[model samples]
Target: MVSPKTRRVLVIMPAWNEGATVGTTVTEVMNLNEGYDVLVVDDGSKDATAKVAAAAGATVLRLPFNMGVGGAMRTGFKYADRKGYDAVIQVDADGQHDPRDIATVLGGLETADIAIGARFADKGDYKVSGPRQWAMVFLAAVISRLARTKLTDVTSGFRAGNKRAIAQYLDHYPAEYLGDTIDSLVVAIKSGCRVTQIPVAMRPRQGGTPSHNPAKSAIYLLRSVFALLFAVTRSRSKIAVQEGTL
Candidate 1:
């Protein structure tokens, strides 16, 4: 394990039309004493998200068009892998994720390959609607069973990945919306990366509309279910092949 002083950390923020919040978010993360380098992947926003992030002293990677959150994260992972970063932490550009908790997430890397900052892990004021809460619990159960470990937040985007997980994602990152959450977890666990969650409080978005509305939430649930099933089936097939039973 590398010491904190020696480990090169990259904090990647995927921004899409978050000009109002991206600057503040970048500045906050860069203010940490952990010496984390900041990179903002501008996901082809029509607004001045890229300009604001760059002006905040973060290295901005501007995509030509909106590639969604997953695509932006994939680009970040590739950059981390190529630049030889020891670990990578992803923070939301909408100001929902607290920059102060970045250290807590990184601390999990001491024993796990991935550290997820979960809002529901402990009692907090973070509240979700009835349907969404139920959906999150159900998905968490499914993921926990698949990974053979108890997990509370399967959909959290506030996460950190070690070198192994970063390298795996460089090639296997899912390209769909919310792919950075559930789908990426499947990829990490299948690749033998250990995962754990740390309790963290979340704040409401500072600005910009949320990507998930009622219709999109339904679509997300359906797609997540199919993706989880596919991941499970694929894992089982690989196991059977390894056991010479395919």
Candidate 2:
């Protein structure tokens, strides 16, 4: 077991024009006193996200252009892998994910390669409805079967990864929309990484707004379903070759 004292944990937040909440989120994570080093990948933000994150005690890595969360998170995984961090916990820059539950998420690393902070575990008031909710349930069911474990929230970005998972993500994490969530986990699971989850109560974004339009949500779900299918059929050898890891 990797003890907390011996573990070097890196909290990575991928920010794209999230200047308002990034600073607050960074500060909150730093104040956790968990000795976690915070790294905010500024994914081509046109605002003061980089400046704010750095000022709030996070190591800021600037991307040349907006690469979305997938690109930003891959950069984070690469950085953590190269720097020898024992685990990488992904947090949102918008502050929906609570930093207090971070330790609980990390605790899953004791027995699993990847630990996710799940929202639908009845631990929190977070809820979903309609087609988006159905899609989430279906996706979780499929992914849970693949991982041979019950996962309530496969789409949750609030998650942690140990060394093996980090290496896998560095090689195959994609930049496509929602690819970071569904596709990345599939790759890690197919590559022999154990996955687990802990229930966490998601909070409202500290700043900015979330899109709750039904039409957009349905479209997003459709794309996610396709991403899942593609990820499932992708063989390890084919994935390696596609990512130039072969």
Candidate 3:
């Protein structure tokens, strides 16, 4: 158990035009405990996302322009590292992930370097579309086969990681969609860091239209799939090298 004097958790929210929902998300996360520091990475939100987040008692990090989700998250990691947080939790600004699940991840951290909240852990609460379901399955299968581990939801954004994981990630993180998950998966596996997944309920967006670019969904899927495949392959090669088998 972490001592009260050294226990510090940072909740990082990568928000883009989520002024309507950012406040609620920040408040819920902050209400969990007093030691949790909330940081909202506003990616050039056209609305008042940063202001609302600050008003809700969250430390707001404003990106001058839209840098996409991954970029915003990387910025959050930087702040987490700079402030010397013991652990950092990645959360969505869409209000889909529950802040209450933070305890699950924190508890799991005792046995793992990183703990991610998986919506598919129970299978009953998952309500995504069929296409997305298939996509996630395909990705999971590929990850399991390559990473040599069973991971139900490797792409989940709701995750908690220690200071070492955060520092390593900020040093060599990717900057695109699904980049956070990919980085965490590959880095944790290659570095021999234990990663655990816990069941968490996710709800549909309570406010604001999704920022997903409909025109790029197909392209993004194809690109991200290939990117993950490449990362998996590269990570495997590194493992082989470390084992001196290559």
Candidate 4:
């Protein structure tokens, strides 16, 4: 087991205009006494996201403008690397990610460079329909084969990464559509990062409007296929991880 006092674990929460729930989410995590250093990257929020997060006891990093989840997460990784953190866990600011399971997800890093919290691993009531579900299934199957492991939710944003994974992400994390989750994983796996999944239940988002819609879900499959193609075809980039670090 990784001792909270020994390993520096930074929980990065990417938020966009989530003033209503960011405080509560941060508070819950802070109360966990898990020795987690919470960092909330305010992705150019127009509202008081930065203020709320800071007030909730998170180290708030306010981006100049909105840069989606991909951009926000990349920034977080860079911060972690600069600060010499042992691990980085990407948690949603919308409260869909449960703070109780943060340790379980972090524990997976003991066996793998990247640990994803899977919602559909017979542990959560979360369900998706239409083309989005099909796209997720197809992507998961293909990625599972590539990673040589079965992953039920490859698109899950509730994921944690060790030092190696952070270095890899800094080298290849993308900001395009679906690139943050799908494309990011493909690059990490190809770069020799071992990945594993931890079953976790997803909670309803406490605040903020749902980002997905019927129109978006309708085109999810087509775009997802294209994303996969582009990710694999991109030129490979590798980074050197420090000795004795994951």
Candidate 5:
């Protein structure tokens, strides 16, 4: 376990067109008094998301083009690695994820290399679609079965990783349909990392529609399932290669 004196945390907010909510998110996180250095990776937002984040006291990293969430996250992870922070926490710019929950993730990080916020662990915090919720549960079960490790929530974006996990991810960003939530978890498991889940509070977005439209949500589910199958079929040699390099 790392002592508070020894731990240096960097909070990375990968945001795009979240100008309405980023300022409040930043304020809440700053009020947490967690001694975190915050970075808001502006994912090519046409709005004043960058300006809002900056005004709210977060360092901003702007991407030239609008890369997806995966790209924005990778950029923040790379910066976290370069800056030599002991750990990095990835939080949403939208007001759904709570900043006060950062401590729980950090506490979990003591025993696990990666600690993810599992919404299903505690009921009633979120009101997701029945089908989508069931899909996540089924996917988590399959991932647990394949990886031989129990994971309650496989796709929740609120997560924190120790320096080791950060280094591996920075060394190689997963590219095969990496934007989807489940595939990223699969890649982390394939790279031989310890993952643990903790219950965290979440709310519906304070503004704007969900990034996943109906058609895209369906496609995401199908592709995520296929990703699990692909990860399962890889040879031991391939897994070893991935482990050694990634």
Candidate 6:
């Protein structure tokens, strides 16, 4: 087991027109005591997101066009894999994720292949609407049963991935909205990665509109269920093939 200090970690922030918050987010992550480098993937924003992130002392990767969070995350994973980073941490550029929890997430990587910063794991002031909360609970239960592990927050994006997960995601990542959270976890679990969650506090976005509205949330939930089912079928097929039954 490599020590945390010896491990090369990259903090990847997928930003799209987050000019108002990316700079401060980058600065805060850079100020952490863990000594992790920061990389901001500007997903073809029309604003000054790229320039602002670069000015904030973070390496910025600008996409040719908007690719959503999942695509940006794939780019970051490829960068990390090519650069041989020992671990990668995903943080939101809208200032929802706390930089102080970076170390806590990384700490989970010492024993598990992935560490998720779960907002509802220990309870705080984080609150969602009644309908959204019900949807979250339903999805969490579904994911937990499928993964055969207890998961409190299935949709949380604040997560740390070790070398194996980084390498896996470089080639196999979901390319849909909210895929970075739900679909990515299913991929990681089916690929035999050990995953655990740690309690973390979340802050409201500092700027820009949220990616999900009420209508989008409904679409997200529906698509996510289908995606989860597809993941399960794929996993079963792989198992059958290994057992010489497929």
Q: Considering every candidate listed, which one attains the maximal lDDT?
A: 4
Q: Runs in model 1 with CA error above 4 Å? A: 235-246
* Candidate 5: regions farther than 4 A off: 175-180, 233-246
CA lDDT scores, all candidates in order: 0.84, 0.89, 0.77, 0.92, 0.79, 0.84
Write model 3 residue lDDT over 184-221, tens digit each, in one string: 57755665666777788888887998866555554655
lDDT of 2 at 187: 84
149-244 per-residue lDDT for model 6 (tens digits): 788888898999988777667657887765778777887777677788889999989988887787876566567677677666654223323433
The C-alpha stretches of model 3 lying farther than 4 A from their native spots are 1-6, 213-221, 235-246
- Report, for all candidates in order, the number of backbone clashes: 0, 0, 0, 0, 0, 0
Give the Cα-based TM-score of candidate 6 against the true structure: 0.92
Which candidate achieves the best TM-score against the true structure? 4
**Model 5 Cα lDDT, one tens digit per residue, 16-68:** 99999999999999998878999999999999999999999999999987887
Better of 1 and 3 by TM-score: 1
Q: For each candidate in turn, give its C-alpha RMSD to the true structure in angstroms.
A: 3.6, 2.9, 3.7, 2.0, 2.8, 3.3
Write model 4 residue lDDT over 1-246, tens digit each, in one string: 455459999999999999999999999999999889999999999999999999999999999999999999999999999999999998899999999999999989989999999998999899999898999999999999989999989999999998889889988899998999999999888778899999999999997888889999999999999999998887655563343334
**Which stretches of model 2 miss by more than 4 angstroms?**
237-246
Over the full model, what C-alpha lDDT does candidate 4 score relative to the true structure? Answer: 0.92
Better of 3 and 6 by TM-score: 6
Residue 173 miss distance in model 5 (angstroms) = 2.7
TM-score of 4: 0.95
TM-score versus the correct structure, for each prediction = 0.92, 0.94, 0.87, 0.95, 0.89, 0.92
Whole-structure CA lDDT of model 1: 0.84
Worst 10 residues of 2 by lDDT: 237-246
Runs in model 6 deviating more than 4 A are 235-246
TM-score of 1: 0.92
